[model samples]
Target: MQWGCMDFRLLTFGDLRLVDGKGSIVPFPEKGLLSICFLLTSSSTQKARAELAEFLWGDIPLDKALANLRQTLSRVKNRQDELGIELLLIDQATVSVNVRAFTNDLALLTAVSQTNPHTALEELLQLGRWDFLARTEVIGGSGRMWLRTQRDRIKTQMLTTLRDAISAMSEGADATVIKEAALRLFEAHPEDETVYQILGETYAGEPQLESARHIFESRRKYRWGELPVDPDPQTLSVARRLFERQRSVAPQLREQATPQLEIVPPVPRGPPKLVLLPPVNLASSHQTAVFLSSALLEDITVGLCVLKTVTMVAHYTAEKIALHLDRDAMLERYAINYVLDTRLNFDGSIYWLFAQLIYAGNDEVIWAERFSMEAQNLPRQHREIAQRIVASVASYIERNEFSRDYFERNPEAYRQYLLGQRHLKRLDLPDIRRARKAFQTALKENPYFSPALSGVARTYHLEWLVTAQGDARLLKLAEEEAGKAIATGQDIVGGYHQFGVAKLYQGAFDESIEAFELAETISPHYADVIADYADTLMHASKPGEALEKVERAIKLNPLSPDLYFWTAASANYSLQRYEDASAYIERMADPSQAARLAAASAAMAGDTRKAKALVRKVKETYPDFKIDTWLSIVPLREQWQKDQYREGLRRAGFD
Candidate 1:
């Protein structure tokens, strides 16, 4: 595994880098580095040159791709004499990595995973980041696909190692290691109640009674708060029992400390509960179709969770409840207000998914639709189908819920308000202007409509974001509109939410936080409100709590929008967790939306190459982006926070 007189190491864990004997980074062209990575990580040490060429440059002509591959291989060969190490072996038709001359972190991890998984887990944690080939950006679609596949493979490997280590805990593994592994796993898979159980047990076994109690109590609260309608009965039972045990043990340890654990069931009196049962597969033999149907239903559930007026039962619990033979009794037991029952059937060629909405109170079928799709297109068409279903359901619910206090008295005004909301969610300058027009029309119909007033306020706020201009006039107008909304409808969540956003942008941190808190009080499960509150908290220099709030928001709206990821990334950046910030940015549908933040994070993380590349991209996209101008408008509560961001940007070669 060693070269004659030099040690070469390829690091593929956090970021891809090549280190020489003296631990200095060895620079290579992008293609050369990628070629090396592809060969090193491939199933076989050797690959056809044509395969490597297609992988790296599949978008180009075959002749040009082969030529480019040859040039990249020649470049690598040219470095051998200067570096005194052979890194690749090339022939007329094949390329192979000199596996013995260099060692790679991935290979080392794989080896350790088979031998000592505890060590593998420790190494995975020590990497401080899980992004593989983080700095490498591939140009071709095929290359991007390969990159995604490799990242998933590495993540699965890490999780498997963590699970293996946890399984070995019964064989007298270190308790600390087990706790850390459990925590890491929990971070990656928060929805898995098994991880929570393991974490609570690990703490309890440590005899840290208070910590164990907190863990169990937190689990219980999460189940009640996030999955409010129907939490997994087994998870709730385990958490409650463990919490009581911890409370019982605490008094014995401290003599005078009498801890009390309370298990309060969630009262189903807030928003109406809407449940989407798992789709019933007519062709049970087609398990793949059944899984896709369930996935589509889950997607619809997540999309519906964003609606402020309806509470969605957790998908896991809905699946369990769907199995009950007596559907009416089950609905009554869960206090379900609406049910979306779906059935999947295949008629030889096309798959038909029939969905219906029923009022659980009277067993009335309110709406039904049958969607047809090809079997091959099921996976790719789920998002669109989910969106259609969610939109139809939301429209029906909105029409039926006119009795709520915030609904405009005039039907025309409510129609205009709905139009404004659709435009506002697009989050662009053109849409903002369009939204303003719709809101203005609504105001003409009913001047006292608070929802329309709030919509007007949001248009101004969104304009500010889209323009990236520090326009005090825009903030003033937005705040004024929000104030009117709040004065007209004190109980409505939209007014409070819009007011908080405007106040935050105006640097009124206390007022903004108070407004968002009130909004939460009004609509406790409003995912967008919680996300904006998290953003306010981050700017107010309370990133730890901000992260917690955003995580809670994500739980409420599992398939959240780009803003949630941006808020999470900002919080992580403020906390100096650069890798985590980058990871969150990558989760966004468009990472370029936060390119500046990504650049700063990479710079702070000591990846200057990546930082500079990102800076270049930012400049290409936004030519007028001056760091000082953006910072002035960012509304950071503390000067130190602004300075930290400025420093990172400057280090990343930004103007």
Candidate 2:
């Protein structure tokens, strides 16, 4: 065979598919692909047969792994009497790719990219490939990270080189080249302010200001709200000035309201830590990426928050993790002992969610099974994931009776709480009220529905906390319901979290800690639990310990709610890391906006100007400000902590 004969047709880096020069397709499983990719990329003696066995089947028993490797080699299906062992050479204990055959894309791409970015990129784009699988997610820890770093570096280099080529184009350069480069950049990074700004400016003749501004605004707001300061000056200025003008005319024009604020206990401490990683997007699945991924993460987080053993990472926290698309790193950074990695595949009316578990210590996957249901099974699917996750960690709960104190409530009421969880995001007063009713109903249905009870308590907490929505009566009832929830959930971590919050609101300190500690013990992966628990400690004037829990929480789930980062930033602010605080807050949307508003206000506070402007935009985005009250409905796990948070907002001049 002539050299590089395998290049006539398509080459895949994933499941091995080799089409001979005659267009015959040969199927090669993962082991084969690894072998192929390795062989093609390696120097002759780099691919040892024994090493290949371990690389392909690292998790399997040694004997089984080696056996599989031999079987794979046998399937190469080439018979040779004299050069038989030539195809399977072992020189000095290293295997070699029979350079006598096989051309590979990965090898091809790597080689091409070194000398020809254009051809390499064109081929890469046309190939329409994602990075290799199984190995990316399944390799042992450090090795997996090394592979990721290498891949990332290559991609960054490709894009950088491509951009440099495109930018350095001579006046008569092919329009096709510029167009392709610009189009790819825009597609890959729609949220990059500078990219859009440049495009908008480049096409200024087309009146792209509004579009550019719109993109900037969307990206600006989409940040998880932990900014140390406002966005880029251009962005902050646009949003700030607009808000300032709106605020200037808002006293008598108040038809809208802010979220109600009622103090709950302080953010508590010792909350359990938990982290959720992005589910794999199945290759063949028809599921919509935006809704399912966000919904699944959010729902699971909220549902788990109801349990005491769970220290549920907040929705925003998971969102940050999802954006980065590094599930393995998330597990490591978060120090998560286990991860709930969910995958969805839709076929006809059935939605199959394959939720898999990876134990951090062993990198052992517990099982991979499909939870099949109709599209309508969305809620149930969330439940299924939650239940299975809980079940997987059940042994831990059993060994620690301290953890068991968290889930004695009625399952059905918990389900009602789950329903309310789904509705929380609709953000309409009616929806919020409906959510409240659901929580109420959960209580009515079970009376001991701690989540609902705590949820209601939080509702009241918010009603009293945010100045715009605080109604004393609303606050009182919230407290009343919260008290009931806590009593019912007395044994669960969630119960304590909720109860401690209520107690904190009522200025009950010692009790809040007791509750916070209980919740922390249950769901150790829940970062919000740690954040809130730490806040509680801070409220109780124990910033030292609060700091410690926050550290643990950050470790358990590094992709935090920008708020946790914000909290740390604020602590930095308190500690005078103005630059660091500013940098961190800049990474957030709401906090950045708030910082801008605060800065603008300082420059001018009775200035409802910023408030009105902020409110208008907030209203447009969240027409249901009242529903935000739900956040505080359950009493905080720590009331003093709640007070401190409220105080911080007040100090920041938030109404």
Q: Highest lDDT: which candidate?
A: 1
TM-score of 2: 0.42
Model 1 stretches astray by more than 4 angstroms: 1-310, 313-355, 358-402, 405-408
- RMSD of every candidate to native, in Å, equals 25.3, 25.8
lDDT of 2 by residue, 1-655 (tens): 4324344343553334556567576444444445555555434436665657655664445578778877766655343222222334444445665555555456555665666555555655554443443233333211222243334444465456555554554544343443444345444455444443333322222211344346446655564133222344343444444344345545544334221111112234443445565554655344344345555566466556544344555666565665575756765665556656666666765666666766767778876667653433444555556656666653122222222323334544545565665566554556666778778887776765566676776665554554445355765566456445544443344445565565566555555665566566555555666777876765565656766777777664555555565555544433333455455555565564345323323223244454355445545655664322632742344455445444433433344
Q: Go through the candidates in order and give each one's C-alpha lDDT.
A: 0.71, 0.51
Compared with the true structure, what per-residue lDDT tens digits does model 1 show for residues 397-455? 21111223334256567556656755664687898999899889989988888878988
Q: What local lDDT does model 1 show for residue 589? A: 82
- Supply the TM-score for candidate 1: 0.46
